[model samples]
Target: MSKMPTPPTLPTATVRPILDMNAYDGQVSAKADQGNDLLMRRTRNVGAASVLFYRDPIEMVSASGCWMTASDGTNYLDFYNNVPSVGHCHPQVVSAMADQAARLNINSRYLHQTTETYLDRLKATFPDHLENVVLTCSGSEANDLALRTAQRGTGARGIIVTECAYHGNTATVTDISPSAFKRGKLPDHVVSVPAPGKLAYGDDIAGGFADAIVKAIAVLSDRGHGIAALIVDSIFSSDGVFSNPRGFLRLAVAVVHRAGGVFIADEVQPGFGRTGDAFWGFLRHDVTPDIVSMGKPMGNGFPMAGIAVRPELLAAFCEDVGYFNTFAASPVAAATGLAVLDVIRDENLLANAMICGKYLREGLQHLADIDGRISDIRGAGLFLGVDLSPNGAPEDANGQLVGDVINAMRRHRVLIGAAGKYGETLKIRPPLCLRQSEVDFFIEALGKSLRECG
Candidate 1:
């Protein structure tokens, strides 16, 4: 038999591969899919990059609201997807897209009323200083542009990111995303700091996190890559949803600004009222970002994203090269985006998120009281993270236990995923239209899943 490779020594809080968390083993999946034609065909189609959830991946045919219907007709309560933030296949958004496509769906090169109207509505949600909006097709493209703009504005090559941050998959952005690194180390220009959490920063999270940024700035300076930007997901979603101590980001952001670095709030995960307390996650910290890259739920899964940037930064970047996306800011995209915004306001989804989020947290806390395995519960609004530990100790958190519980939850017909550096935190992010009954159902399923895992 071939010798098993020795696992590398990891820190107490190690950086786990983002894509591998709660992901199925390819070799095992291949063996399991021996007789399954669909699964085998999928493997043949996508090959090695085919990353599917669960050991036994379900073929989903249709979805609505918070539930996904599998091919076998079983309904799975979706707690994993955040793409359809306003709820899956919302009628208003679908109608807007279809109508616009039928009427006129031209590129941004031509002036369109719907495009400008959508920009006006979207721009109103951001700070006044962020006067320029550059549309893109995905969060990756948005972030790539933000990075280039930051570099151009500051004339620096360095970036600071959270230890396990997953900004995007673009070649340039990937260099700064530690979680995306499967084997190689981060590029020299990009520096990573421990996530701003109680474990890393103790009592004074704000000060400690800022101090780390200062150190990162110095390191980048020493390497001749002066600070360009401190880009982060304000909620720290990939770093395990660390959304406590409200304004903890203020000090860190100030530190970055002092070092001549711009602040880019990568809101691909936390934007569009998902956090409930504020329209954007950065708003909760009261720190104005030089650039804000948003996607995922922007068009409610319609594949539209953009960056809200300070006018000066955009101007500076534009001086050297022009920026335009052929498919972005189209009449169809604008209409779809407008519909999402209208739904958010008309349906009072933000208020619902706050109400439902509080209820969800309370239920999780109640579960924690009964089950000592649940070590901690963190986050705000609808985006929460539950840490699972063996023997009721945070330091002894077990990813294996978390994986088992996730599988158990799947067996109970509730879909969920994992997060955190150790893959020990349950990443719970349902749609904004989550109701009291759905929260109750999730809580009950979780309790049962915990019991089953035990």
Candidate 2:
């Protein structure tokens, strides 16, 4: 056999936990909003686990399209939420949920026409091979189920992921998500490779990424875990949005398959036309995932998620254990999900994402030309990552600079967030129904924010 490519030397930047990046630290920020009544109540309610955005979290009262109205009557252009993929408080989606709830809302165990219809519509979007769909209440549950299914199907405990990936919040999925860990290290059964980016792989991302996977497989086997699955968000959202040189994931996927492991595409971030290039992010890479886990935008914020798997794999897993969810595939969820799909089709949001994404990138490039601190811009469709540095050097990326810019953007009435290992990449994800005028507004706000931060 031909020798496998060697893994490349990676950067030494300290990886930031996904939740900690751009998050409000209660200890430090408490004094700023000390007299705020809502803040006091929230702190008392959720306490230490309350993760709010910004140094001063805005209290949102209402939202529509791509704008959110704060309690103080300030309307901010939303650029950080993907949960409302089609738009915020979409009338059709809300109406569907209400109508179904009024008529009938029952669990998946019951044979409901709306539930089956929604599943049929959803299944038509995937590859023909993924014939089985399992519904859940959240992306975390979907990922949890996917990992369990992969483990059962392959009889291996080992799993592989990108270094800064944020799969979900469940106990099982958290082990595989390096970005979710605030203190402890990943378990031995889980291994992570550097994300597919020029900083790590230089010119040959496909070869370098595949080589890393090979090394990870070797490490897992040596640890007596072997390989169960190689799962990832094809867009690599948390790893600074590495979505370029399409088909880069094909080789890495092949490596996993050769090692007798399944490939799970975590589409929680890049699914439902958010990437624009394809309906699902994996479709852009041209790789066949053994299982595709999705959520977040499934019901356009209605709390529904699921995994589409190969029939054989699902059957193999179900043979040993029974599975069911109390709220999954409910009539209300089905109606809401169906409406989301209809809105996507009717509004031509996919094309809108593609066109608006190009416009947004071009505007960002203009900003990059003027601002040396704008180190790099990466992403597809409405999801994007813009790196910030003290200078023009990407190796010297500055999370502090990003933090200042994010807060400044908020002051300019545009809300955004951070990503990447060092929290140096501005994670920009607006509603899919974004307009050109709104794009212009974001670009203007970003320019001003960069100037202020610089």
Model 1 deviation from the true structure expressed as Cα RMSD, one decimal place: 4.9
Could you give candidate 1's per-residue lDDT for residues 1-454 as a string of tens digits? Answer: 2222323333364547988888878687666688889888888999889888987888999999999999999999999899999999998999999999999988899999999999999999999999999999999999999999999999999999999899899999899889888898999999999999888989899999999999999999999999999999989998889998999999999999988999999999999999999989999999989999999999999999999999999999999996999999999999999999999999998898899999999999988888877889999899999998766677666677788999999988899999888898999999999999999999999999988877
What do the candidate models score in CA lDDT, each in turn? Answer: 0.91, 0.92
Can you give the lDDT of residue 388 in candidate 1? 84
**Cα miss at 70, model 2 (Å)?**
0.6
The sequence of per-residue lDDT tens digits that candidate 2 reaches over residues 243-310 is 98899999999999999999999999999999887999999999999999999999988999999999
Candidate 1 collision pairs: none
Output the lDDT of residue 48, model 1: 86
Give the TM-score of each candidate: 0.97, 0.97
lDDT of 1: 0.91
User: Candidate 1's error at 339, in angstroms?
Assistant: 0.3
